[model samples]
Target: MIDTLWLIGIGTGSPAHVTMEGMQAIREASVILVPHKGAGKDDLASLRHGIIAAAGSTARIVPFDYPIRDPALPYLERVERWHDEIAARWQTALADVGVSGPVALLVWGDPSLYDSTIRIARRLTPQPTLRVVPGITAVQALTAAHGIPLNDVNGPIQITTGRRLRDHGWPIGATRLVVMLDGEASFQHLDEPDLLIWWGAYLGMPEQVLDHGPLADVATRIVAARQAARAQHGWIMDTYLLGRPQDAH
Candidate 1:
């Protein structure tokens, strides 16, 4: 009965991203699950494999194909269906192996942030005991890569998607924002004056790319760089911090 599941954060791509605690979780598990999101994105899975290998984990590695969301469904519905499908796959994979001890999943970042792994884990037949080993988050990596503080003096930080920032406008009273899951490069449409932008793609990876300046000055450059990087790598995971010009030194 695989009732215990270790949700270990593997951090962004770098092998050094996984924490010592995360490494220990990998070593203690009887099996580890890795998800593959189809073709042209082999690097994502390979990165996870590399992290596991670097951790010196001897646990059985089980790879599963992630389900694509149905295009016809509404946005929320599509995500719900996709999550259910993922939960089923997790169950089948572990049961098929007859895993007896603690099972683990190498989450890309801290399981608590913008990740549905914990939600999916709860969908299991009889929910497994989840112990999360936190690792560095993309937000942390983005700020570090750019050598900037996440928030201004006595300012509140808002973390939202590029879509929300596009649809609803800048969050009211937010002095800074860390936008994620923004494939559409939504910042190009913002006409706010004195808005500074700091963007990075493939954070913590060898092929990392970064750009920062007044949004008006560097929007086009960031767009071009994002396109070129995605074309070369077949995938991109990026985040950006937006703040007023006064926020920067």
Candidate 2:
């Protein structure tokens, strides 16, 4: 049985985004699992390394190849199988490191947000005592970068994925919606010019980009920019806030 599991949020690729509490957790960990998505995306693993280096954590570092999900499978099934594989990979990594005490995974953004680390963590047999250390989320970083509030005063905000927005459209009664982990630029699907979007990529990182405007006018630019950035970086982490103007509230 695993003793302890720490899912430490590392924010969106920024070392400064690492919280003091998260640093402490890392320093206290006996083993750390770093997932490598291969070259070009080496920055992902590097970010975790940077965090450890910054914190001066002497924890044993373990690297494992991340499992790629079958694109042909149905979405839910694909995700389920992917998480299972990740859990299995974690188990293997733990065994290879020969650790019996505290272990940790450095999560991008906040663990409780759109991240699936928690879901995969639950699949571990016998389960480890979980300790979560929160860090800055992409939504918070995006909103702050754009100088906009996440929600209208007392207004409800919906947080959803890109697939949901593309398939189901805007949610009712949601004046603001935060979109994360969008594989598709779902904003391009919106036909409404009244809807305004504040989009950011690599939030809290040095190469961060921010754009905002009516959806129709800026959709093309956002899509082209997203595609170009994804091509250049091999991977991209982005989030956006959609808002409809309210009556002077």
Candidate 3:
């Protein structure tokens, strides 16, 4: 049984985003688990390796084939089974390497934000003693990349997934929103007239890209850029802020 599993957030594929605490965890780890997301997304695993190396960590690196969530099942059920399989994979990796405690799994972005690492860890048999080193979140990275404030004055800023935005439209009366995990440029589906968008892809990385303008003016451009970047990079991680402008709000 694993004694301790450190969930260290590396943040947005950048070595600079790793916190001091996260570096310490990497350095102290007996084994570091890295997940391979197959061919097109190999960079995701590479970033984790880079983080560990940048920290000068000499820990054993154990790479495992990440399980793909079954799309045939409903979303919730598919996610539950995927988590179970991942937890099982972690167990197998640990046993194969013959290490128990002081294992580290580098997480992208903050562990507490829209991440399932902790939830999956809970499913481990004889559950590990968990430690989390919080890293920067995409929300923070996106806002900083564009040099924009997350909210206007004391107004609320709601964070939701792209699917919700597509299925439910804008959150009622939400003047500011941060959209994450949107595979489809869901904003393109909205017919809102006065909305504005600040979008960023690969935030905080060398290949970072940003765009902002009146939604009507730049919607197509953003989609084109996103598609081209995905084609070039084989994958992309992006988030966008949608809101009404000063007078409109």
What TM-score does each of the candidates earn? 0.98, 0.95, 0.97
**Clash pairs (backbone) in predicted model 2:** none
* Tens-digit lDDT string for candidate 3 (1-249): 688989998888679999898888899998999999888998788778888888899899988899999999998999999999999999887776878459889989999999999999999989889999999999999988888889998888899999899899988788888999999999999987799999999988889999999999999999999999999999989999998888223
Candidate 3: residue 33 Cα off by (Å): 0.2
Ranking 1 against 3 by lDDT, winner: 3
| lDDT assessment of candidate 3 | 0.90
Q: What C-alpha lDDT, on a 0 to 100 scale, does residue 72 get in candidate 2?
A: 100
Among all windows of 10 consecutive residues in model 3, the one with the lowest summed lDDT is 240-249
Runs with alpha carbons beyond 4 Å of true place in candidate 3:
247-249
Question: Can you rank all candidates by lDDT, best first?
Answer: 3, 1, 2
> How much does each candidate deviate from the true structure in C-alpha RMSD?
1.0, 1.5, 1.4
TM-score, cand. 1? 0.98
Q: Between candidates 2 and 3, which one is better according to lDDT?
A: 3
Number of the top-ranking candidate, with TM-score as the measure: 1
lDDT of 2 by residue, 1-249 (tens): 467899999988789899999999998898888999977899888878988989989999888999999999999999999999999998887774678679899999899988889889899998878988999998889988988778788777889999998889888666788998787888888765488889999888777888998777888999888889989899888898888767113
